[model samples]
Target: MIAGRVRGVLRPLSVVSIAIVLVLLIYGLLGYSVTAVVDGVLAGSVTSPSAAEQTLRWTVPLLLMGLGIAVAFKAGYFNVGAQGQMYVGAMASLVVGLWGDGRAPVLVIPLAFVAAVLAGAVWSLAAGLLRLLLGADEVVTSLMLNFVAVLLLQWSTSGPLKSRAGTGQAATSESIDAGYRISTSTGVSVPIFVICAAAVAVTAILVNWTRTGLEISLVGRNPVMARWQGINSTGVGLVVFGFSGGCAGLAGAVEAFGPAGSLRAGFSPQVGFMAVVVALVGGLGALGVLLAALFFGALRAASLYLPVVTNLPQSGIDLLSGVIALLITATGIPLLRRRRRRRRAPTAGGTSEVADRPVARRREVVAR
Candidate 1:
């Protein structure tokens, strides 16, 4: 019995393990030196002091956004509006920071953060509301919102928030006050790390410990069953959407305060989408999300360093990431089909046994 159970557990894991290895082998055969690429990624991510800092800088936003994506996935919502939500959050924070007029850092910074979070929540809630009320498809709405948010950022930085003495191809708002800035250009700071840690901790607790978390999970797994069980699935959907948006917004605020330090058009353009990849690779669990974020963060940090150290272009890294995402998604199909077949096979055998046994029992009773 123990051996049977062990085999059952190992079967799924072995399949996944083999799939990952196959992906690596394919990449290796594509004229990419796996060893060299791995070494370069590690060197760029954490071998040196500056490299480690860059890794942390990249990890923070990815982690935050991954957590957000996990929340939406848990609640059965596909909120692809994270990119747009992040842009709105950054824009909101920039407006607050610029207009605060030298207010106390304690006062202004917190306010800006709150504004960022609220902006993200409102932006996401629009999609959720549409999904609930108008029965609109969220994927389309969220994807379109991303472009709208990008344009909004361009407008804000180029028009009202344009730097007074700027001369460059890229438009940017004025630099934030030094005192208000969270970190230097290097992007690692004590305060920002603390905020990210707190966000992750609180989110994890909410998902694991709270009643709402249980309800949301139920809703995701089966909305009809959740409603039958007396859970308010609609409320759960709204909460998840708001929470996801808030997390993305917080990431945007961190970028504005720590690394970017000003509103810039197209800043962190596809990072939000990349966070979805991180969440999926991490297995959509909090701990998985954290680890996956670190891995992707390392990739982002390494991408910058690769050009300096190797002959490869940044496009190579992009292509590699895209390949990983595609493979992971494609592998899900066979795994799911196998699981479904396994489940049905047992049910079919049990039904046949029940049919044959009842007839045999009746014959034995009549013969006796």
Candidate 2:
């Protein structure tokens, strides 16, 4: 039993170690000093209070989006349109904030947040509806929607919402009112902290403590089996998709009100994709995503700082993320899937372990 627990702990650690080793080898082969790369990472991530703040700033959005993606994955749905969802959410927030310019910040801010969440949910559910109703592939529909969202952002910023005060070529919307801003440019503030804390609490409770959570795990592991046991697989799918999109939308709101203070075309282009990687690396769990987001946030900070300290390009950090993603795909995800299958399968004693509950509890659920 002790050995089994140790192996379980080491499984994730081994994947991380291998990814790091591979990154070091790649950098070494490219003629960059591995030590300098390591130093640059530390300096960018945790060298000082300012550095830590920067890391936290990136971590906030990543955590939100990662949690959203993790939830969808838990229900066996692949909602890859976080980028589009975030864009629509940002656009919704921008429109609301701009429309309510003369209103009180307290009222306007909450309205903008609601608008953002609703917009994101609708955008995401569009794809889910297509998948469920029309038998469309969600991965394709969701990914294609990303391009549509980018085009929408481009047109809106360049046409309807364009800021006239900007002389630069980059298209951008007018800045949000100062009162509505939750954080400064650094993206770290009390309001931001409160929001993240609330999200973590709510998500943990939803995923770990609710009957819905058990349904999600069961559906993910084996949808047919879940259906056989009278679970509403379609409802579970929609719930997860909506929840995931809402989370992504909230992240966009956080970005706009906390750090960005405005909507810019093509803003934070990689954050959505990076968040997918974060979810996979995190083992699709709340606690794991929190830790993984911090890890990637440090990498994000380091990527920016590496240009200042070494000859390496910023894409080097992306390469590291890509490598880690590959490793997780090959090892972590498959391992988890297999283990889940094992738990659901019957043992030699003719008793099933099930996913979140024992076989007896599963029988009770089926009977109901």
lDDT of each: 0.78, 0.84
Whole-structure CA lDDT of model 2: 0.84
The residue-by-residue lDDT of candidate 1 on 173-280, one tens digit each, is 887788899999888889988997888788888888999989877777666556668987568878998999998998999989888889889988879988877766
| TM-scores of the candidates in the order shown | 0.84, 0.88
Clashing pairs in 2: none
For candidate 1, the per-residue lDDT at 151 reads: 94
Report the alpha-carbon TM-score of model 2 versus the true structure: 0.88
Weakest 10 consecutive residues of candidate 1 by summed lDDT: 340-349
| lDDT of model 2 at position 300 | 87
Question: What is the total number of backbone clashes in candidate 1?
Answer: 0
User: Could you tell me which 10 consecutive residues in candidate 2 have the lowest summed lDDT?
Assistant: 342-351
